[model samples]
Target: MLKPVAAIAALAMIAACGGSGADESTPPEVTAAPAATPAPVAASTPAPAPVAVAPGEPSPEFASLPAPYNAANYAIGKRTFKLCQSCHLTAEGAGNLVGPNLHGLFGREVGSLPGFAYSDALTNADFIWEPHHLDEWLTNPRAYLPGNRMSFAGVRKPADRDALIAYLMLETGYTSAEGDAPNE
Candidate 1:
């Protein structure tokens, strides 16, 4: 009885692996072992260097703002960023959490912040942290880099990504001097 069950199981495994088509004369093919499954984008990876800010850094409260800075989309983005809060910190002096602090995130090199030990994939990334790149990354992090270690499934909606980036630009290490207008 056990022998019959084992035979059935083996047959099922072969069928699942697509083994039914070959002829008796054909030689068996060898394939490489599969690589590890990529982690989700929302998950945190390691960063090496020690940060200046403490884990729970305090920031000053701001009064009401004017115009584009206070746009509705920006508000939406702030809400969207809540999804990222578990891994990253937005306060000016906040230290690293599961991921790095996002205080002055834009215009900086990817994975270049000192004190955080970054995975080789991120540390070797050549691009700077611009809006477009951020969009691609947020769309699907595992697709972006198959083996880097972020684990949260990415945000699929374009609108959500847009709002989140807008918020990050405004709230994370933004200076009043760098107004919303593009630099000539």
Candidate 2:
């Protein structure tokens, strides 16, 4: 009785995983070892497929991702940063409180805010905070770049995130390629 049910379920899984999508061409591994008395159930479930991301690159955002990291966006970022004003400051090289000063975020290492007690999650991170990375991080923050110290859920507005990154780009002195634009 149990063998009949298990056989039906195994057939279903084989059919489902036998797709030519992302996992196409990959051979399936046998998890349930063949047994003398005919085992009751599939011992272990097949591992779920990995999510596909573009190779060797970060996901792009904004137009040109607003690179040269626009001055307008930086100014806009300052204003949007007002949302953070209660807890943060954006001068030259500041520190943290409810949050950090955010003085030099761009080009800076992730989770590398000086003097601030950072989470173990960020301190070990290997990625640099760049315009593209910042956009991604600010997009969903916790989801985008997990392990960040920020407790505030995150800003949902893309424009606001853009502005904030632009402002940080200016502070970090990651000079933009945009012509004739004085960084804010």
Candidate 3:
């Protein structure tokens, strides 16, 4: 009776250790706890920086327009603006679509859309949408305004852009076909 009691006591002691010590040859069942944390080492390097603006105010991509309005150039601007009309409205206070109202937009301050949210791309983009600035944007809107939501491929031809910009200036009352200020 004493020997049996001793064997039972030894078995209880082995179980208390949390490791099964039934026999020297018997394998113990140990459940590993799940690793709840990730390693501290960074798996990948950060992404490259963005290239958007010039060093100073809109690095003179387009020199301010020369004195005389080039009829020929304005014609080109008119045609170029047709492409812009697809995304932008040409009427004053028109409804917003992909972009804001462009009527009287030439001299308007940037990011003043009544209800539309402009991309940071447009607000920070130096230079008003003047004839010269529009020319560059129509040339390549994506490059001109990186991260701009408008997905225009941009007009490639200078003559075409000039015609379109001329029209925009005239329509927006920013300049005349002769490059004079619009008649008040």
Q: Write the per-residue lDDT of candidate 1 for residues 55-156, one digit (tens) a residue.
A: 222111222322222332544565689999999998887899888888888777898988888888898788777666677789898888666678878888
Model 3 agreement with the true structure over 71-92: per-residue lDDT tens digits: 3354345445676777788776
Local distance difference test, per candidate? 0.68, 0.61, 0.60
Candidate number of the best lDDT: 1
The total number of steric clashes, by the backbone 3 Å criterion, in model 1 comes to 13
At residue 45, give the lDDT of candidate 1.
75
lDDT tens digits by residue: candidate 2, 1-184 = 9999998898888788874345656667769866669559888999744333343222222124344444234345556777777877667765566876667665577777778777777788787666776666666668875777676667787666656765555544554432223234
TM-score of candidate 1 relative to the true fold: 0.55
- The reply for model 1, stretches above 4 Å from the true place, is 1-72, 175-184
In model 2, the clashing pairs are 77-163, 95-101, 96-100
What overall lDDT, based on C-alpha atoms, would model 3 receive against the true structure? 0.60
RMSD of each: 21.3, 21.9, 17.3
Q: Which has the better TM-score: candidate 1, or candidate 2?
A: 1
TM-score of each: 0.55, 0.51, 0.52
Q: Let me know the TM-score candidate 2 reaches against the reference structure.
A: 0.51
